[model samples]
Target: MSQIRKKWLETVLKYKFNHDKPGSPTIWSPDLEKISRERIKEIQSEKLSVAFDYLYEESQYYQEKFKQAKLKPQDIQSVEDLHKVPVTTKQEWLVNQTDNPPWGNFSPLSHKRWTTDGWMMFTTSGTTTVLPRVFRHTQHDLKMWAWLGARALWAMGVRPGDVVINCADYGPAVAFWCLHYAMSLVGCPVIPCGGMNVQRRAFFINTYKPTVLLCTPSYALYLGRTMHDLEYPTENSSIRIIITAGEPGPGIPSTKNRIEGLWGAKLHDDFGCTEVAMTPLGYTCEDEVNSVENPVNVHLMEDAYIPEVLNPDTLEPVREGERGILVVSNLFSEAQPILRYMMGDWTSITREPCACGRTHARALGGLHGRPDDMIKIQGLAFFPSTIEDSVRKDPELGDEFRVELSKVGDMDRVKIIVEPKSAIPKSSYIDPREKIQEKLKGLLGVDVQVELVPYGTLPRTQFKSKRVFDMREQCY
Candidate 1:
């Protein structure tokens, strides 16, 4: 190991070996479920108020915002009073950047103070039109991220020593690098093979014979398809478990089942973002499905931050089970304290006790796609995730596909390009094109035309896959 890596492993081992002192719950705890809802709310409210004070003093954006709202920190007396404070929105961040280019007006500290030793920076993929945001982490952030990852791995039933093949990308991406670091913490030997070089990936799998697989859903499907073409028994391979993240598929039943059946591994899902430091929303084995029973308590890093969710339309608090935009308030981050910062993803909060028995608020369905991932098709809105779900259900269709919109003559044409699952007798198989089209019409209430192509036609993605290729001029 490199000197830095050696030091990191030493730190990890110290933390893991010393974790039995009893400050936090064990990997599984039925008593955590018994904690009353009111107590959780009380803790949440206290953290919010503390976060508000931190932001008001440190961030210029929140300072001005509070001034304009004509509210004082004392006015936010209780957690219920949080409703009186205005809701943060994605537009605020966009507008702030427009008002102040590069680092926005909300930036809390000077650029120099943000420097750290043995730290890394990860950039977000600008999903819509906004420029990508950069997230910085110190050695401390790396440690915390590793801790949560260790928890996630343990929940997946990963023992102390195992060989894990990390299929996530490298360089500036957090998911790929952070996960590898975490696996190292748990004493799992990690192999980083990112990108979509199918033959090479297959070669590595066959040669290395790893016990655990880490990859995104899209790439997982691609790898599975490559193995299938070679007549390899991928499902019966040596890999025992697949820990998935970046996009929600390993957790989604149909996609999960297909991957498991193809790779012969159990799938576990995780959720996180570049903006939230290194902590993640991970799955533990105590639940039936990785439900909203448990979540990483980054808030306990009250020394570190606070998190929230709000309704985008009404700027009101969404009740548990109601979808809303995710907002965060970083309490302890003095270098760049984000107070009431709005993150554009959509998901619901669940306050109920989970089968696993943790009282921490759970994002019930992971991130239910982003708010901006919606597209209008034949006057109805459709999310690509929904389209993907429909397409993947049919085992016959290859996972690689794209949605393209174009103008032909007087009307708008919606075209879905998909590769077939296998090269075997196309005549004997029902065309997945017609099948997907029918489902889109039935589920999305919009008529869409589907096009079929040979396997390996669509370009593979390493990180976030582009599901749509809009070719229409007038639509733009």
Candidate 2:
């Protein structure tokens, strides 16, 4: 290890082995986290040197890719040169899986290699536009994931003594298993409530009274309502911190406010995907909630993952403050490492200092949306998040809704089918729908058709919410 890495690891081991108490969850490695940009690059270069060499040697996918790109492992030594290696997309990854069964060639170490080493297998939920992507992580990668996960949880106010209830479905997926293990590493007791129904989860929350909750934003609202409907007092629940991942709800101002209002708990967003996750465990601190303006930012753990925002069409870097698709490269992951992977989530990034005193890069609008969710109204393209930001802002609408895109005769059109909140029962949601359509028109630069449906008519999910219904490609 480089001297910087050696010292950094020593500091972390001191905290873990000696049981050193951290002043805050965000203070994992203060010395290195806030280190100068130049210093971080130097450390990143050293780690990348080893990572690239490993990729070149272990996997035929990367070996052939490097040859096709006419590049050597040494040529790309730092994050700056990552562009030289083409971005890996979900399409390419799925093709690799088809070409090679179970684990793709990108898997540096397969299950056979992990037999003696001990590894965990996780696959993408495949809830969105793409097929599921599988990954094999060794014990070392899991430890690293847990460390970053702790950083995210800490920023979200999860302390060592806090008891966390993670309600996500645990599987070969990302959220529950990784986050449960991460909270465990943080010295917090994690109640794995994966297989429980909403009523059972509510019962456990009132009985056990965990201080923190790990779930999707939609589930938080669902569970809280269920608790109330079941005659269980939601206010009496012990949860104070609610962390959401897997979807783009908590980041939406209305959704965030609603989750906070219902649970009486501060909501934090933990963002990452199956490909390259928890490297920085996207986190939100007090600033995300308390800022006078623009506090809704997700801090990327930059110390471990190099993030870039590039135009999806051109695949070139976007201006510093401009919004674009997020592409990430893992600095530490060795099992199934992805380099310059087009993460498909759209957002703008800023290296500016956070109000919460974190210096890591932050995504301003959180996850905007995915490629499959993109829609064109008039001449410009917009994501589901654009509509989500507009729809959730209306207090008359409930947290649930569906956005459908189709060809209205010869013109491309967008229709927002929103569900009314229980607060305004039996009344037509026309006023709110009109209000939302007006706001969306002004914000999205196109007229949007709005229809308000009765509450609970749309599909609701215990996991991630599937809000976009696109029928534009169908031929009648």
Candidate 3:
């Protein structure tokens, strides 16, 4: 390795080891997690200085970006100067990868390091029209992932005696793999349910008697309902905690209550994207979950990450309590420590001390879906999560619903297809459908058609659920 790269890695690893407590049962790292706000900012400032210098020296993409912005590494020495740097978008990375093929220049991982010490490659789902964005990590990154993951999991009350059942497919996605290794570090035995179907997974929960279930919020609900269909009551299962990622769970009250009520387990939210896979950047703590707050908060790991909330329209910082999109700077990884990367989730943050005794900033109400997923119709804009909150609030509704959008002679039309629970008679669907429509109209300020389908009409997913289908001519 080059001298500059070696020095950068040594500096970051030193910070990681100084504050890490891998064996703690209550708090992962008291020195870091419970430190005063001033001390936290000092640590971030020092690391940000070194990280920017390394990125400027090694990463060609960042070098070009700095040149265009008329700034140098020294210009961004503290959190106060973060606005001088341009915010990075996913589309920019996609274009760079398209021009460069396979891996892009955004990351500092060179071919030599990748071949010698590469750990794994993770990619986006690529469900949209664009190609999937890929990321490669080194062996050094695996250690960071394990340490940070262990801290977040430990805060969520995962102990040595707990048996975790990971239900996500062991694909190129980063969440499950990171949690798997972290569980090993935490001394918890994990049941890898990657290749199993929902029915088989439900069976494993019954036969193996795992204590913790890990999957998306959608899959958790689907699995729990399927267990009911197979006569395996989830409420009676051994699972005590359900750790969910890949979708909004604890943020939506109706969805959170439904999952917790169905499985008789506490639902914890783990938030992060493929680009920021070093750890669960946002997580729920024991106190946050047990609090009487209607919508529980997710704490951001500020020591390992710097989160900034920017207005979606102006790309400027909003007031502390105001809602805006999230942009993060990863200060803890080896392979892909991206700076000012736009995560695009809509939320607000506060630096007030949490009841859990952590001084890090918490994302209020968790993340409420991304701005890219927001839908507009008839001069009104709203997110699919709003629709989800309305649909899931109705007790007669099943676990599946979809928002279908089409054009009706120069006018936009939205139709919500929802399934009634099997116990509800077909004749009784009329009341529930009308109720859902009324609630949606009140929430969105626009009229929408509601269609009631049979119990098994809509399909269920073992991964992240796709709830929107836009069939407008403009979409084509």
Candidate 4:
């Protein structure tokens, strides 16, 4: 290794994992060492049966669903038998809250028992079109989150004494809180820059000089721009590991390269959800993510939850290497145990032996995209993530952009609103809209009207960024 890499690794090992040789070939001690395909399936079978019985008896929503599907706890004898249980959706869960209000039949307990040790409530964002669904979690669920998150950081080189800068907002949102809790468990001092102004953020980074920075990939780009504007040299910043979530960055080659180039730090990608606990998937080493196959298996808290993937429409398990919806059930979360809940996210499994020598199954490309994020125009289906990936490659464009879906006559009209980076000068003689149109066409294979919007006119959200607007009024 070069002098810089050697120094960075040394700092990481010394501070984060509390070890001097984290990446040594003989230093393999992952938490998921015991899970093989057979073991995973066996664990899934036991947990599914437990989840099914608990939900069928205690959860009103699942009780009704079980009756509708004619599923019995005994029917779910094996992981294969889990197919008999109907898959539940976020939309259905949202509607359940409406009928029941506040917490729904999904709440696995009487309201009197809600404030118990395991139960914790969180709120997700919903626009005027949808009502925010309040999610419930148990302390056991949170522990699983901490274990997976800490392991990912350890693999990514976060040392114990090193400070980590976190900017993701905290509210009723579970993602933000879970990450903060995870960093604390790792024994790292967390710098909460979530609500700080740009100047304050710069000051915090300068004062603390954290070894790791955590936030969404988009926000990380925004931070880089803000630092540049403030004349703060990122190279001088002590941040060596850049951890990003809410969207893929470390796995996406172009975005990863851009982030690392700008911050002069290593970028690590983490994937997880609010409904399920945070830190489900993450990259530990620097090998090309796709090339370094197996996942961390998350230790499962196996006592807390079980995981599986299936064909969204057919509800049948997909063959290995095929993409499918991710479904999970929690065993210890009596306050609100999700039984075979469909998460809408897609991931492919790989049986290929990982270089890390861990037996846990890996998500081939991290998260491909959410099944519900798909948009069909002119009979062609596409995702906003794909469009964003294409647009981000253009150095002239800013990280902020919006996708508007409206109906033009009987056809769906797709339009893109761009906020160009200041790097591209705003001159009376130049038109950036045409260049955006060309790039979108070349990348999406579809023509879209590109509108130039003033910088900062579009809103920035701390939780899930609303980059896409469905004016067509179709939210399914």
Please tell me which predicted candidate would have the highest TM-score against the true structure.
Answer: 3
Candidate 1 lDDT, 404-470, residue by residue in tens: 8888775778888887777557788776667788888888786788889888788887667888877
Question: Quick one: best lDDT, which candidate?
Answer: 3
Candidate 3, backbone clash total: 0
- How does candidate 2 score on lDDT? 0.75
Regions more than 4 Å wrong, model 1: 1-35, 73-78, 95-102, 105-109, 116-118, 194-196, 230-232, 282-286, 290-309, 330-337, 408-410, 474-476
Order the numbered candidates by lDDT, best leading.
3, 2, 4, 1
Superior by TM-score: candidate 2 or candidate 4: 2
- Candidate 2: tens digits of C-alpha lDDT, residues 225-320: 888888877766788888888877556877777787888878878788778764435778766765645338888877577788999899999998
For model 4, what is the alpha-carbon lDDT of residue 444? 73
TM-score of candidate 2 relative to the true fold? 0.90
Instruction: State TM-scores per candidate.
Output: 0.82, 0.90, 0.97, 0.82
lDDT of 3 by residue, 48-71 (tens): 777887888888898999989999
Query: Model 4 — TM-score against the truth?
Result: 0.82
Better of 3 and 4 by TM-score: 3
lDDT against the true structure, each candidate = 0.63, 0.75, 0.86, 0.65
The clash count of every prediction, one per candidate, is 3, 1, 0, 5
**Higher-TM-score candidate of 2 and 3:** 3
